[model samples]
Target: MRVVVVPPVPALLSRYASLTDPVPELRAACVSAVAWLVEHDDARIVAADDQARRIGEELLAQGLAGRVASASERIETRIETGNILVMANGSARRSEKAPGHLDERSFGFDSEVEAALAAGDAAALGGLDARLGAELLASGIGALATLADLTVTRAVMDYADDPFGVRYWVVRWECAS
Candidate 1:
């Protein structure tokens, strides 16, 4: 199974298009990852909330050329496990100019998450501190927690950044399901 973890930032969606892409690199990573997920046509999105869900759907539409899948519709098309698109992000307070302002604790938290993704360690990802994540304005700690069930055999991160003080990661994992 293929599992992809991407930030839920709305700026990546076409609806939120600006004069110039605010997150050009992030958008590129997200689009490429989504394209990879849709190659098998078994992408299932796991979002933290309504906003995350929207971003996932928008990404799917972009990947599939406007062919977006509803949750029920996607389930009906497959009986076995398939690709996973996890909409989550780390702390948004990496610097003084960050959305949540500078929080020294964010570095530790984001580093732990980055390490887990780089190592494909689900156990470490499962143990993340949601309370601290919330205090630091992490977008999808719950969604990241849900991904603990995945048994990854290999992991590759295509992008990692905190451009707007929000920690975003685009990671792909090969899982043994």
Candidate 2:
């Protein structure tokens, strides 16, 4: 099975579009990821909340546009029925400009999550402190926690950053059944 995780950043939605894109790199990552998933395989979306779900679905729909954007820059793969799309994010308070404001703890919490994503450490993801994650304004950590059940064989971190005080990641995982 293939497992992928991406944050549901509000700016990615079409409703929020502007003349100049605020999240070009992030949007590119999301589109390429979803395109890869839908090219030959259907997917299941897992999100901790409604917004995440909506965003995930939208991204999925975008894949139907049948545009890969670039042949060399994005992934190319045959797909199957076992692809998973997870909507998740780290703290919303990585800095003072963060929506939740700088809480200091956000740094550590985000770091742990980032590490788990980069390494495909499902155990570490499951071990994340739920209370602390909540306090730090982490989005979709619940969905991420659920990923512990999967036995991952490999992981690739496509993107990682805390733009606008919100830590987001684009990750792909190959899992063993």
Q: What Cα-based lDDT does every candidate model obtain?
A: 0.85, 0.83
**What is the alpha-carbon lDDT for the whole of candidate 1?**
0.85
- What candidate 1 gets wrong by more than 4 Å, as runs, is 66-81
Error of 2 at 94 (Å): 0.7
Best by lDDT: 1
Considering only N, C-alpha and C atoms within 3 Å, which residue pairs clash in candidate 1?
none
For model 2, how does the per-residue alpha-carbon lDDT over 1-177 read when each residue is reduced to its tens digit? 778899999889999999999999999988887777666566778888899888887787677557655432222342235788999999998899999999999888889999989998998888899889889889888889889888889998988988899998999898897
Q: Estimate each model's TM-score.
A: 0.90, 0.89
Over 36-77, each residue of candidate 1 has an lDDT whose tens digit, in order, gives: 877766677888789998898877667766345554465445
Give the range of the ten consecutive residues with the poorest summed lDDT in model 1. 71-80
Task: Give model 2 RMSD, 1 decimal.
Answer: 5.0
lDDT, residue 119, candidate 1: 92
